[model samples]
Target: MAAWPWKSLARSRQPTDGGDSAAPGKLSLSLSELFVVGTWFGVATGLLELGGTLAAVKLMGRVTYDTLRTNWHYFWMTPLSNLVLFSVSALVLCVATARIPRLRTGRVVFFLYAYLTAWSLVSAIPTLHKTAEVVLAIGLACVTTKFLTKRRSTFLRIAPRAAILGAGLILAIAGVDVYSTNRPVDRGPSVASVAAVGPPNVVLIVLDTVRADSLTPYGAERDTTPNLARLAREGVLFKHARSTAPWTLPSHASLFTGRWPFELSADVGRPLDSAFPTLAEQLADRGYATGGFVANTQNCNAWYGLDRGFDHYEDFYENATVTPIEVLRSSRLGRYVVTSKLAQAVIKRAAAPVDFRYRKTAGMINRDALAWLSDKGDQPFFMFLNYFDVHDPYQPPKEAERRFTKAGGEAQSAANLARDAYDDCLVYLDSQIGRLLAELESRGKLQNTLVIVTSDHGEGFGEHGLAGHGVSLYRSELHIPLMLVHPTRTPAGTVVSEPVSLRDVAPTILDLLDLGTAPTFAGKSLANTWSASAADRDFSEPVLSEVDRADHVPAEVEDAPARRGRMRSITANGRTYILNGDGREELYDLHDDPEESNDLADLADAQEHLHQLRELMEQVTGVQENGE
Candidate 1:
């Protein structure tokens, strides 16, 4: 309840020209002054942004470094937007200040900044009063009033600087992106005599959220993966198929580009950067028909530029016609309370085709993939399936959950039960897999074609206080099931203990297809691990994972925004992981803490292991120790 000093100062005001002032009659808010208000708004927006982000982190438990760096991005992304908003705010405030007004612009702006910053801090902290956020928000209005009254000249200088900094940062990142990406790698490795017109149509099925161990073939309790198990008996089942990332985008990116998650992680929301070649693109160039069906729009052709290689590149699922009520219930308050109406309106407009079902509108995708074969239009085919069933809001139909857990919604409400639902979804996915496999077989293309079954990452249903992923570096998050089913693979029904990452998938697929070798590929081919002798087996390489949002993890409550996805740690050999979060680095031996409950970072015995892992991560990612 700070009193407005600026308003009092203006009460007994006199004109600079010593003329008879008309009692500051009607407050005037012009278009130009409004624009300046917007300029001031740009300066103040960071505080509101900081508040929102802090609240998100408080609820989610962690925030990635890159997202925090988005502040660095807003520094540029919204200049014109700021102009429009500030212009409007300024006009209204000016109009009020002149007449029927008790508000001061400069005072209000200053108070708002203070209120928002304090509120965010209070929200982020677990201790203290619960009303901190409300108090802070109310206090901000006074700050805004003060801010609006500040001399117009200071705003002029600040506005341009803010815009420039953001723009500069954006340009710099773009330049680096251009250099890092742009290699035309996928195009270079051409297949010799690329088969055309039904040379064993290949179906690369990607089961979203499908874990390697969930299948009964892998000794799970439920017959959840009946179809996949049957396929295992008929074809080669790679006991170990690991995805490079714990999330969908990077994992799929690795599959498409044969790169590791760390390398491809930055490519999320962006395409494959046009430098790398995709299997579909490669096949299309060689007169092969390429088509894909996916359940999620994030994995669509448009966002990631995946539709480039196909002639009939159809992603009709963009506008989901049907939606579930469960999703409606799951919406957050913030979704409606987007501080700005424009932002809220934009979100609503874009979300017209939103879906909350276990099965998205994927029937069209299946039909399209199947159609590619029906036409058999004088071309070989490379088909793909992206199943998004296993992701969050794990709704596996009420009946399926009943089969696994005794409790219904109550059980499914728990993390472990959701995992059970995920398993059910996997089972359903397997049935779909069966249908695809049968179609391929009916066409007489099963024997000669290479079948690769794998996941982007595993699900973590409250494995460690964490309900889902993008939070930790635990084995539950990183260790994935990787299987490669080939027509003439000599090592059938064989279990390989060698550690593997999703990075090698690209190179392995290309190798099998008689395409070019992966010179720049950081992963070793699984075929290499299947050496005839199997005597000298150092089959796996040190695997690295990162979560730039340190505080996003439960373990990192303090020390926010350290190293943006720098290097949380690495899993060397297969057992040890040297983890870095919140400025402290720890070592864990999976031999002992498979649950990752124990820390061995200080253990003298782990010195060599830790050194090697750190070195390995540094070499691949180009990230180093703070002092070093």
Candidate 2:
């Protein structure tokens, strides 16, 4: 008997030509068969990967020229990498199957081809990696049967011809695609007329779910964000900055368009209307190269219309196309064969804890940002970066988590541990920010860059019966840290206490660049307020923050009625007026009740202000009291 069951199984098979089959324990791939199988495997893998990547791009609605140009390497490199990996796999499988007495049969080759096709299809769908492995196992089982062993010679003769034809067709299509993508077309005078005057590059970094109070610069007792504090010293800080909405979608909409959320059709799941010009569109029209690097996979993705006018939009979550080897290595049964014992031991001892702790942390984000920055030419560029590090599921790196809380401590409650993790995430984010700044400085881009640091909204730490954002219009959820660092225009150590809304960000950036704001913009430019005398400052307008709870509800909530429970909060003159959609109102003197502990709604002096603010909300959103 042979040393292995497969070798014995090979010897058990009868020779088709009545000649002696291969002797026991002597099964290996001949040079000629190896050449044919290896070439066929390479060509088939390349073709499948290219075809699948193009299909995935179409499915993702990212087939535009700009997207293809920016992500060209990803499309080609991923497939070529898979081709190399699958070639090695094919060689091993070929050698093993050659040991069979029916080695001259082509069923094994066809099975390898089928398996490669399955891998290409499933690898594009990040959720179906395990499914591909299952398909391959079933294919192998069928290929090893007696039925397929009988039809070997005829199958072998036909497969090579079919593979060559398929390869040629695929290569031709791929070549045409490459040519079309690289071919330039007329962009018209609008693109040509928008010449650059060496304006400062703009970098808007949104720290998702980061509250103003959590940062050291914002009076947090803990040193949660030392880098941000240093950044504040290098520019100006708006102490009373507020987001237009208490969530990612509408807040980002307002920030990009300089329009109030209600001014446009801004809501979750609904793409922003093309009629509303985004900051990127405006900058792109003005000869500025625009790029977006967003880590918030849920809200600020391409399907949500945040990719408008970005020459290069690289969302980390959009990296769904991986190699088949990755799929096999991740599979349950394949893990026993694919991974080495030393690798398994190291992963168990070293990688497991770190993997459990951090999930695509800010370090990866900074690396991508730096790479893009290196590619961004001297043209004035507008880069929109959204970091999800400070968002929920706050699993900071083990080192960071250990700095704040113990692994198995008494404070293991979800809320307490989450808060500790949140702080650690902030520290980790600060380090990333520091690294980004260093990279920019090293490249001499920092001096010419206008860095705007802010957040979509703040997280709720069980305040007002809320643990996250987007559900309420409370102070903790509306308040955000807004800081600006400009080389020549913004003076260092400048603090602006006047109330400001994030909707003003777009107009302020355009205003600084001398690019006129659009007539449709609801938010006025705050350029004068950036560094103006007390007399020149305009502090009359109340900063409005709103939350449309009905539109923002989670999809899992079944049988949820159309609550129409939209709430709007307006702050002016140290007072906040909240008009809950059901004709109820609350007033708080933010000066004395910063935590919003005291409700002064019934007071006669506060009623007039509350009524005025309610009228403003009604005028803005076109929603009256009594729940719509």
Candidate 3:
């Protein structure tokens, strides 16, 4: 039987199959032992992974079990899932390796450096503990394969039944322990809050890839969001509203639950747990008719459960080429596997690319949304409408594209010039909003309706090393525009600059209608802001922003010893932390370098500020003593 890998790290009492002492006076293990260790490590890690993830479902939903088990699903993550997985794998490997006596003592120094590097990465993308565990397993396998001699490497050799039985017993105990951790309970009265409105109609519109500074009301260079501008001029606008996480899933999750991405699964790739009560869920329980109309394929994934609380969720790009996963799946393989593995493979390839590419212009999504809207019959509804026309593949209508290219933007890329098309789409969406408003008015429901318009974090336009969104947490990603067009009784033409978080939106809405629920929500209400003047507002520090990019593991080659690992970021205390894939930290003062063009790690004062911000960040992200 092959001895465990750790047994080979140094000499042990066990003899090698070769019957020869592998090394001199120092004890040594045969190569076969190493392979066994790797295999054992991999199997245990995979099981741990399954167990840990199950726990995540509970953690995210803040639930033990279901009352009826009607709709129990999976975990949902935002953008940095790959990064989270990588970090978590390291932590898992760390614990597993500690069991190896020879390997444990000999690689103390090496393990310390490795673990610190791993911890730094794991902390950034907090949800990927499973991914990290897997990576560690793979790491062991890789090392074992590289060192083991071909002599005993053949698969034909098998461990004796007794030894195999022992290993299996250990594994079974480990799995059971993990399973024991999950004690399913009944939160019969699952929720404690309800919005106190006569079921006032709630309309949440998320404009995908909309840049923060692009709208005229926000002092943009162009009149891109004229319709939104009109609404801002007459409604309440949150001047410093920031998204909790980048990308669609995480940001949207925050928007719905008023929580940060890390608090949930954090692996935007996985399915979200349904136990948590989102805003829509709350409203639905309150007897409001709920529905969702989404244009982005990213928002319509099964894992996200954006359709969790809605009764009628519409997928508009059905026959269109706009469905992101389907398009990618088709590109990788063929249409035959459009809704399967091919789609998933394509998504990773397209998203995690060397550079980036642009596809269509915006308006198509808006048209679909409008089509869906034309059929609505008001029943005090809670409807979510997300439009991705402003997102990349910036192909605008030819006329709009021509208008911009001919007027001034001819020098831009196909995607950029398509901005006109995007602008046109945004305009169309606004017009559609206006139409909806008119419809409500015609039905005498306009005055009582509560309209909230926001972008799910803004897009990046060639700012840092990226374009569009999903790269960093700068003003571009977190600083989105939010407007509340409530009943006139709530006030109007108000702009709140009070450092409001997307996490606070749910509480704010509940509070607005005098909903008798505890205001335990993370976001503060802008309802009162509608009655206050801009100068009277106190927004201490811009809204907090974070971009944990730990998962982008660069493809590496063995011969080339310079492949960097991954980077994770924390932006607070006026300094932006740039953690590189190579396990290096870079600090930049945003006040000094708005574009983040310089690293200020050596600045003593800057480091002091960084220290403070880090403190606040940990609290905001909720690192409780209870291990939440």
The backbone clash count of each candidate, in order, is: 47, 1, 38
Q: What is the lDDT for 380 in model 3?
A: 65
Off by over 4 Å in 3: 1-199, 319-378, 398-402, 407-425, 517-520, 528-542, 549-602, 623-628
lDDT of 1: 0.54
Per-residue lDDT of candidate 3, residues 34-138 (tens digit) = 333333332333333334444544444321211011111111111112212323443554456444534433132122323333332232334457557446644
lDDT of 2 by residue, 1-628 (tens): 1124334444455344323364321223343554455556555566555565455444543332212222223444444444445456656756665555365334434444444555544444544556555565445435443343454445446546765665565445546765775576443232122223378889899999999999999999889989999999989899989998888988998898888777766565356767788899989999888888887755776656778889888763434323343333322123333366765676577645212112355776776666666545567888888998888878665555445766676657777888888898899899889888887776667777889999999988877656677767788888999999887768899988888889888888887777888665667777768556787776555588877768545554332221347777888877888877665688888789989878999988777877777777666566665344
Return the number of clashes found in candidate 1. 47
lDDT of predicted model 3: 0.51
Residue 357 of model 1: what lDDT?
A: 31
Return the TM-score for each candidate structure: 0.60, 0.67, 0.56
Q: How do the candidates rank by lDDT, highest first?
A: 2, 1, 3
Supply the global lDDT for candidate 2: 0.68
Q: Per-residue lDDT for 377 in model 1?
A: 39
**Which candidate should be chosen as best, given lDDT against the real structure?**
2
Residue runs of model 2 more than 4 Å from their true location after superposition: 1-197, 318-321, 325-359, 398-401, 549-564, 622-628
- In candidate 2, residue 23 scores what lDDT? 35
lDDT of each: 0.54, 0.68, 0.51
State the TM-score for model 1. 0.60
